[model samples]
Target chain A: MEFNASLIGQAITFAILVWFTMKFVWPPLTRMMDERAARIADGLAAADRAKQDLANAEKASADRLREAKQQAAELIAQAEKRAAQIVDEAKDQAKVEGDRLVKGAQSEIEQQVQSAREVLRQQVADLAVAGAEKILKQEIDAARHADLLASIKAEL
Target chain B: MAAEQSATDYIVHHLTHAGLVPKTGAIFNFSNMHLDTFWVALALGFLFAGLFGYVARKATSGVPGRLQNFVELIVEMVDTQIKDAFHGKSRVIGPLALTIFVWVFLMNAMDFLPVDLLPAIAQAIGYYGFGHDPHHVYLRVVPTADVNQTFALSLSVLIIIIGFSIKAKGLLGWFKELLTAPFHAEGLGMQIVLGPVNLAFQIIELLAKPISLSLRLFGNMYAGELIFILIALLPWWINWVLGTPWAIFHILVVTLQAFVFMMLTIVYLSMAVEDH
Candidate 1:
């Protein structure tokens, strides 16, 4: 239990050890631990951000899908209306064409009937003149009877 | 070996240190070196610093290895203690506390070794290699068992505490506080009368820190070592009956003493830096 040189010796050794620890041991380990803590915090923050982004993206996609569905429904309704309009126009055009064709056929038939009547009238007139000539047996002057033939033609 | 000597001689032999003996008329001379205490303490100090230094060099911010994890556990424990007790910013306290805790712990752990193992080896070496008597080669492996070693550390802490106090409050301020504190007076006459008393109390308080710090650790380790030696003197078969339980209980003492020393040093430093 004597105080001796070992006291000084141990003190020197103790000082050296403390110095070594302060210089080389404490700082690096402490820094690494702090750095690790910061890194973990950053990682957690990033994960939270990713989660938020994912939720936002999902909402955006859902909104776009709803808009697309709405647009598709509007387009279908417009196409159906256009198809009905086309069918109505076709029916109207077909009715107008049929009316024009019927009018033309009626007019043509009237003109042909008038021409046939004229032909028949002219033939009857010629037959009557021939009968009169046979019955008379005497030669009549044709140039002088022009007015009478015209009257007879008109009566027939 | 024990059959020849009395129990007293065996216990005294175990307590004796292998070192340079003091010369005549010089009981407390520096020439008297406790070689065992110095060497063992030096070795343990290096072991503590070197291992920590190596681990600190290789330490990473990423996932740590097993050794790194274990080292970090201890370093963090000490760091937390410092942060909790020490509010002032000083770079020295952290490492100092760590060194004290780990070095003292390792030194105290020397109690776990069989009491006669190191001494027997030293005896064999001295007998075969140096032609000395086997019983004369005394070696105590536990450095903390030595008052000199414990005092050396505590004295160093005391010096650091004084340095901190002076740094915090200048020398004049510190002296002024020493004379004025723990007994503030209302007037000049009361102050004059109380100043010396306060100064006396302050000196005793200052002296008490190192004394208590050194003696606590030294007493625990020394007593534990003595008990182990006494247990070793018992019959070989019965050794485990007492040895195992004592060793188990000593584990607590060893770690607790180290923790107490470190805590006290930090507390003292913190107290030094604060005004009364």
Candidate 2:
């Protein structure tokens, strides 16, 4: 129980052990724990970011899909309107051509009628002259009947 | 009556240390060293270093192994006590506290071994292997039971306290504190008159820390060791009857003493570093 050099030896040993533990053992272990904590935190943050990114991408794609659908509907409506306008123009051109053809045909009929009427008038004049010649018995005063012929023509 | 005589002789023989004998038959010699206490303490210290060193080497940032968990538990326990007791910043106190707790606990735990086991082996080795008479081979395995070992540990703590006090307060500040604390006087005459009283009180207070710290552990362990020895004096059949109960009870004493020693050391160091 008495004090001796062994006490000094143990003290020195204690000091060395404390120094060794402080220098070698403590720092790395504590650093490992701290590093593990940091890694877990980073992983959680990255997961959160990835989740947010996925949501954003989904939203963007959905918006794009909606816009594309709206554009397609607009394009179909425009095509239908253009088709209706083309059909209307074709109908109007058909109506105008029919009207012109009808007018031309009417004009041709009137010309033919006028021509026939002239021919008829010529034949009638010949017959009337012959009867007059027979009735008057001679080539008397033909020049004097010219005014009647003209009046007959004006009446026709 | 012969059995009782032998039992008294047995307890006295076991109490004696295995060390150098002074020629004058005097037991108190400054040069004397307890070889058994020395060897056991060194072996346990190596064991502490080896186990902690292995864990330190294999330590990872990933999931820990069983050994790593156990080592970390001890480390954390000591670290918590240090954090609680020591408010000031220090690099040394944490490891120092850990070492003291583990080393002293291991030393005290040596008492749990059957009181006769190591000594009997040492006696056999002495008689057969070394050709020494068994009667001359005396060994005491529990190191903390020895006043010298416990005092040595407490003295080291005292030294650290003094070193930290000087480092934190400066030499002049420490000196002034010693001479003028627990009572203050402004005038030169009053200061001069109060200096010796303050110095005496401070010295006593400083001296009491190591003494109480060492004696508390030594007294508990030495008494426990004695009781174990006394229990061992019973006949073989009755030995277990008393021995088992005492051994179980001594476990708390052993662990508590170590904890108390470590806590007091941290408290002392904290006091040394903090301003008055």
Candidate 3:
């Protein structure tokens, strides 16, 4: 096909305009946009990684807290058991000491009773001699009191 | 009779642009007017910006919804292309390919609209606002379909390739490449035959890039546009029969043009970034 002058003109015009656009218009704009796009992608990736890390840390902390609570409960149970055992031992020891002390006091009381009876008997003997002297003129009562005390002792 | 003349006139009028014509030898002529080409491109650019910008701005961190995912898929594909084909780090190339792909696609996509849709509206306003004939309205939207647009793109890539060649091979290196490359045979007498072969190869390779780049976009789109116009030319009754399939198939054309342009741009940039 025959080429036209106008077509040639159009072609030249197109070449010039394209050169102008490439040099002046397209370069800076595309550069800035590409940079922005790269930055945005990087920012998004960082955010995702950070979120994952945060979730992992939170789960780890929760697990640690649960484990700590279990340990604390076990320690408390052990302490309570130890305290109850010590209290039971003290109660048993106090009961044994009370029984021993009661037995010793009973033996001491029996010994005191025996000594008081002997003293009372001696006093009765003296009282009988005095009564005999008063009733049957004094010289004969002394000899009768000795016989009366001896007989009273034998009868008791 | 008047209607035919006027119809022809309207097409001729739309065909002519508000740009300066070369007085034959001018390498480049810039048009300050048609603020239309610049503004239209800018507006389309922003429209793209807004649609995609909204997707980016509203993107959820979770699975991307349909619109955002679709856009991201395209962007990733574009990026992977640049990464795969282009050598070295080009902070500028990936997005440049993106812009070219999107801009050209948008330009070509304009053809899909009823060819008369915009001009029809223009004529309506012209009838009242400017007190002109409605049939005289003219407009052409697809910039790449405009040969100047495609050539301009190819030339820019051409300049970039030149720059890369210079940067990679110093002037001395460039000269050495041209004179001594394709050093085919090592035998002492084979040097004579090698010279011509090397020269031809060099010439062929040098001519290949711009021609291929320019023609590839031009051929596909021009053919696609031609098919559309031909289909549109069909009678109303027959249109229904052929139109649906053509239009459905054209969607593939639209998507393919965009993909091809994107891949080629990446390939060219990759070549630019290479040492060879």
Which numbered prediction scores highest in TM-score against the true structure? 1
- For model 2, state the Cα shift of residue A150 in Å: 22
Local distance difference test, candidate 1: 0.90
Q: Candidate 1 residues B179-225, lDDT tens each?
A: 89999999999999999999999999999999999999999999999
The parts of candidate 3 lying over 4 Å away from their true place are: A1-70, A123-137, A141-156, B1-76, B122-138, B187-193, B235-240, B272-276
Write model 1 residue lDDT over A1-156, tens digit each, in one string: 778889998999999999999899999999999999999999999999999999999999999999999999999999999999999999888899888889888888888888887787788777776776676536644566667866887899
True contacts kept of 1: 0.91
For candidate 1, the chain B TM-score comes to: 0.96
Model 1 lDDT, residue A24, Cα: 96
| DockQ scores for all predicted structures | 0.59, 0.33, 0.08
Candidate 2 chain A weakest ten by summed lDDT: A1-10
> How do all models score by TM-score?
0.88, 0.76, 0.72
Task: Rank by TM-score, highest first.
Answer: 1, 2, 3
When just chain B is superposed on the true chain B, each candidate scores a TM-score of 0.96, 0.96, 0.76
